[model samples]
Structure formats: structure tokens, C-alpha cells
Target: MSHSVEVYAPQNWTVEQWNFVVWSEGAPSNTFGRSYATADWLLTQTAVRPLVGIVCGSGLGGLADLLKDQVAFNYRDIPNFPQSTVHGHAGRLVFGTLKGRPCVCMQGRFHLYEGYPIQKITLPMRIFKLMGVETVILTNAAGGLNQDYKVGDIMIIKDHLNMPGFAGNNPLAGPNDERFGVRFPCMSDAYDRELQQLAVDVGTELGYRDFLREGVYCVLGGPSFETIAECRMLHKLGADAVGMSTVHEVIVARHCGMRVFALSLITNQAVMDYDSEEKANHEEVLQTGKQRAEQLERLVSTMVTRIEYNNNYS
Candidate 1:
């Protein structure tokens, strides 16, 4: 690191803010200013004022395809946005209506293993907040840790175990920006209970009971899959599923006072037995997602329509 480079931080910036700007590749420390810039640019590109924001997970880019009258921007074209380098992520920010409600969906999302700073990983949530998104729906591909969970099951995230946060890499680690939320945000009720129930009701109506289940998801910083021992430990610790993303985004969205609902598509059962020949791989994750893509899309699209009528979020 060079000691001679003195970067300019906006007036009244805190030390934590300065550190994030100097370290975060995208300089996402300016929660209000930088996010507002992206939001303003997006507004200029499309007239849609999204009330709900959706994040598409691995092998789930099809979620964006459901948007009607779509307008989209590549991550590179979006100011201060980090590009998605991983395969399976289309890396676009799509805006349109879902069931007649204006919405924006991330065709792909960022992850810790992508090498972005923690702040950069959660920058899109702030951008979504600035874009008039009141409710957020996030989806991801996860390895089921629960022995009873099947590969094609869809787990409604009722809670999460943030392995990264436990290691001091939380997205909210930087200076507290009142413009975003309180210095110490309450996360005990992070996943909105009402939204969870709404999803349950919708899933039942759609006859998805066999595959729809609710459980705790655990997020790990990963490009590599979890070890057998690690999988066993996480399951014992109460995480029904494990994944590499979604937790950070959910934290940021909730920090900014957005109603959050998350879903995990169990793409593969975690390799919990050392003697078992099953090797956890990315190809299998996408393949399973391909098989269940239509059902996942239907579940979300139906829930989106009813979200407006749900008095809790409205």
C-alpha cells in the first residue's frame, strides 16, 4: 500500500468512510452520494419506479426474463457498479413490470469470492433503496444441509447464519451513514415474517407444497464448495442450507429499512459424508436449477402480484 496517495473524501466524511473509499475498488463508501448517482442515472434510462427489487441467483437468470416491457443496463455501464465475472451471471440490471407492479431485478448478484470489498458486495442494495424499492426479494442456489431436503426443494429463508460477519467482514463495518440507517441496526427480525407467510400461502396455492420448505440458510464466502466436515458442522449449528451469497445483500437491504424476503433453491445436497462419492460441483448446481427454473419463476411472479395487496408492505 502506498502512503503518499491522499485521496479526497467529501466534506464531513468519517474515518471509516475514508477507509472504505481508499480500500473498496468501487469506492462505495459514499452510500448516499454514489448510490444516488446510479439511481438518478437509472431513472433517466427508464421511467419505472420500482417498489420491489429482486436478485437472481446462480443459474436463475431466467427470473429477469419474466419482466414485461424490459429495459436493462450492463454492470459496466452502470456507474460505480462492480462487474460480475462469474459464469452463469448475465450481469445486468433489468427494470420492468412484474404482474403490473414496477420492479427492478438483478440478472446476477455479487459475492465475496468475486474479490470485491465487503462494501462493494452490498452496494446494489443501497442503489435499490435509492431507486424507490420498498420491498426486496432475493433468491440463491444453495447446498441443502438438512438430510431431509431434496435437490429440487425451494427453502424460504426464515433466518441466516452469516459466517463472514462472524469473521469481521460484515457489509455494515464501515462508518455509520445516517442516510442509510442507524449506527447499530437490529437484525433479529431480518427476514420479514409476513413476507415468508405470504410466500407459503402463494406456494400452497400453486401446489408447490412438495418442494416448498422453510429453513435457515448459511452464507459462506465461496468459490470452493464446503468440506464434508464443515457441512456437518453447519448443519449441526442449525443451518438447513448453505450458499455463497444473498446474506450480505439481505443485511444491507434490511439495514436500510426494506422489507426482505429470500429464497434458496437447493441445487445439491451438501456432501456431508466423506465416504460418499458425491462431489459438489458448480455444473450440478446449474443443472438442478435448470430443472426447477420454471417452478421458481412461477412462485416468485405470483408472490409479486399479491405483494401490492398485502397491507403489511403496502
Candidate 2:
């Protein structure tokens, strides 16, 4: 999951090199530039400056509605923004207050499976960093890969195995913009440990002691679910939850020195040991995601409040 830093010579340019610039046609001088421009427009429209950014996963758009003094911006209205075309996802940006902290929420997100490039998929995270968001809470709907994982459980992502990154596809692959981050960024602990413990403590206080689990998330690029062999391989590689998104954004966030906390809503089992003719589908994923939305909302809201208070007064 590491990128090699090689100096590019124009005469030695490969087709891949040409495609890299083509893929990132008008990405600002840096991600922060693009983000700040968008945030300026958003601030003008809403009069709120977001300190934290939350990206909503499948069937979880309702979390954005809970924000007070909310201002909405459709993805179509943003320049160079790709629209999310998946079911169970609402493509909008919401600015408002949650737990007395000004926050921004992406009610929907773009995925690599949606025919977007890596840089395009991670555009929102860059914007969040530019807009002064120091921390990010990313949520997703994923299939449980661990044998003990059950339906409707909430698993906190501790680390991730990025298959896309391993395959030479990375959001930070193109150019080394020292203005945004270092050429080689270390990712020893992608998810913030303190924020994770806060989530665990919050869940416990809310009587979710037994249901909250923490483990590694394996990220792959997919619109289609995994095959049995793929599930087995992922399990062998130490993943508790497997999904299509999050890892790319986490990398972008970390590159910009933003703390990240991620959670996965276990929508269905990975179908590794299933014998019934019944299969998993998006409908079930959406249903389970909705079922657990309320608890997720409570946990994230409390965590945000605590983070703001601790950072300001502690």
C-alpha cells in the first residue's frame, strides 16, 4: 500500500502518465485549493464553518437531517463534483450544527465502482481538509467477514488492508504536492485510537456494550459483492468487515493531517459459510443500515460534542 517516489521525465512519459493528468484534468493546484474554493461558496450560502466532516454511507442519509440550522447543496451544483448514482445514497452536502459544534456532512459519496477515477472519488475529503475540518467520521455499509460477526452489528474500523492501493491504484499516486502533504506519508495508524475508544465508551454508556466490535476493514473496489473465495481470502488476511469505500478518503484525510474515525454497519454476512440458496442483496444491506442508523447517530453526535469540548477547553 505504499507509493514509490520517482521523478518523472517528459520524454520517458508512459501512457499511464498521460492518463494521470487526464484523470485529474482541473484538480486545483492541490486538494486544499479545490476544497477551500468550494467551502467559500458553501460558507457564503450557509454562514457556517465546519470544524468536523462526516461522510454518510448507504441508507444513512437520515443522519444529515438531524443537524440543526442545516443548509443543503446538491452535488450537481458543485463544479467538478461527480454525482452518486447508487441506490440508498442521497447526493448532497449539509452544513449545520450537531451537539453545538458546527459540522459538515456529505449525505452521499462517489465510489470507484461508479466509474469515477481515484482522485475524483476522493474529492470531498480534500475539500473537508481545506475547509478547516480537523477530524473526520466516516461511515459505511459492509459485509461482515468474521465468523463471529452478526447482522446489524457496528464494527469500528481499527485498520484497513487496501486492495486498490496494493493494485497500484491510489488517490495520492499522481503528483507529489508538498503543499498538501509529504511525498511519502506514513499510515501506521489510519484510524484515530482515542476517537475509537470514545466511540466504544459512548456505546457502552448507551447500553451497546456487547454489540460494538472493533477490527480491521478490508477495502476493495466493487459494485458487485465478493465471491466466496474472495471472502475466504480476505478473512485469512485479517479483515472483520469488507467494503468498497472509505480507504481512499482515509488516505486523503491522513495525507492532510486530519484525524480519522471510521465505522462499518454490518449489513449482511460475507456469505463465506452459507449453504442456503438465499443470497445477499442491496435491499438487505439498506435495511440493516437503516436499522442501525439511530444508534450510529447517537454515538457520532456524542463523540463530536466530546471532541469539540476536549479540544477547546481541556
Candidate 3:
């Protein structure tokens, strides 16, 4: 049975006749039913049983190579899945072992700015839930909004400011599917506290002291970078990091009762007041991500190792 959700479009959206598209067929069994089914089907063909799911951020697909014996599946092969179209996104899922733990990772991700609905953007995490992913590590490339943060630093997501989804446009806006979660899921400490500590511990152990930071992440709808005014406003709003992804995935993962930990790679500084001739762009973001890719890889590998060890020994 397909679930129909009631969506409220913003007043500005009415001029464009932006209405919620009702899906009537092949609806997810639960909120995460379809993707879970697809992922489970894929996992059955492989020997690995994933303990966690990881999503690679823009220009960060290369991180999947760190996994051993990867079984890759294109997004097109999955039923009810959205294809990734961004330049940095690879549109494939890699199932393998990362740091000796069974893991499945997305080499790319769909964005709301890519014309995909919020539900489609978060569908993969639902699949992760079905695949028995008890925890999720979401990584994204973002422009730095905090004054103290520098490019190439990794920021652990402690909380989020979901300005887009809460404004009547949400992946969970439609009908409440009780199988996935309750109608009103609480957002307090949505990012698991213990998991956050584990990430921090790993970062500290690896001697990435100054390069690692933790703060609130703010998500925005964007194919374009934010303006100076917007960046300053976000900073004033208590956001330590700003990005275009992660928030939706975090919400879906949390709704499915999975533990979530998100990290943001600071690609560029949103320096609106700078008088120098520097600016933030996609090329710059990708280059910075590439330069810091090894750091991110090590950080993630260490964190995963810790999670598996603690979960197994405890």
C-alpha cells in the first residue's frame, strides 16, 4: 500500500504551483521498506553483513576505495531509488569491510537542489536500516561559516538547524508511517551522543587535535553557494558548519531508530567580509576535499574501528 503525505508548500511556492506529488504505487513497505529490500537483496549476494552505512560527500567518492572487497551497485539497479546527478557524486553503493567491520557506503548522494524530492534524497538510509545498519556515519563537504574554522578541517556534527525541511518541505511530511517511526519524533540530541564521543575519542587518539572540531551543522537547499549575508546570518544562528546535505539523511536515520554520526569537511570559508580576491566555488571545494581526503579517510577508519571494537567487546 502506498502512503500519501500531506505537504504544505511555502507561500512563495504557490506561484510556481509547487504541490506535493502523491506516490500511489510501489510505496515503501515502511518509510524505509523499498531501499531496505533492495539493499538486503544486494547484501544476500555478498558475504558481508554491514554493521554500519556511510555516505560520502561531494568530491569524496574516492574514500570508498579504502574498503576491501567492495561489491558495488549503481543507484539505477535499486528499486525506488533516486540517481545521483551532481558532479562529485558517483551514484554507486559499495559494500565491503572498512577497518575490519562489515560496512556499506554510498560513493555519492542525491541533493534536494537536483530536483529530487526530500523522500528520494533520504531513501538510501532506509535501505541501510533494512540491511541491519545499527549505526550511520554521514560525511559531507561544506563551506565554513564559523569564524574560527579553517578550510580542510573536519567538524563533528553535534546538532543541526533544519531550515528547509521544517518549513513544510520534508521527507517525512507526507503520511506518518508508524512502521518507520512515530508521527512526532523528538529532535533533542538527534545525533547520538555516545557515537559523537566515539568519533571524538578516535580523532583525539589519532593526533588530529587542532584539525578536529565539533559544532552544530546547518543545512540549506542549494546547488549554489550561500551569499555573505546568509553566511553571517547562519554564523549568528549558532551554526559552526554549513552544508547542503547530511541533515536529511540524519533525520531519516534517526527516524528509523539507527544511531547517526555526521562529519563535515570544511571545503571553503564563507568569508563575506574579506577584501582579498578569493572566492568559493565547486573546483575549489573539490580540490580542498582531495587535499584533505587522506585525513578524512584515516579519521573515518579509526572511528569505525572503535565502534566495532566497543560494540563487540562491551
RMSD (Cα, Å) for all candidates, in order, is: 6.5, 7.2, 8.2
Across 1-314, the per-residue lDDT of candidate 2 in tens digits comes to 00111111234656565445435657545444455455545656776778889999999888898899998889999865679999988899999999789899999888999999898899888677656677899999999999898998999999999999998999999777765678788898778889999999999999987789999999999988998889999999999999999999999889877889999999998888656565779999999987889998998898899884224210
The whole-model C-alpha lDDT of candidate 3 against the native structure comes to 0.79
Between candidates 1 and 3, which one is better according to TM-score?
1
Which candidate ranks first by TM-score, i.e. highest? Answer: 1
Sorted by TM-score (best first), the order is: 1, 2, 3
Q: How close is every model to the real structure, measured as TM-score?
A: 0.90, 0.88, 0.87
What is the C-alpha local distance difference test score of each model?
0.87, 0.82, 0.79
What 10-residue stretch in candidate 3 is worst by lDDT?
1-10
lDDT of 1 by residue, 212-237 (tens): 99999999999899999999999999
Candidate 1 vs 2: which has more TM-score: 1
Pairs of residues clashing in candidate 3: 5-174, 5-175, 35-127, 36-127
Lowest-lDDT window of 10 residues in candidate 1?
A: 1-10
> Model 3: per-residue lDDT, tens digit, 102-171?
8988999988999998988898877776666778999999888888899989999999999897687777
* Residue 163 accuracy (lDDT) in model 3: 80
Supply candidate 3's per-residue lDDT for 4: 12
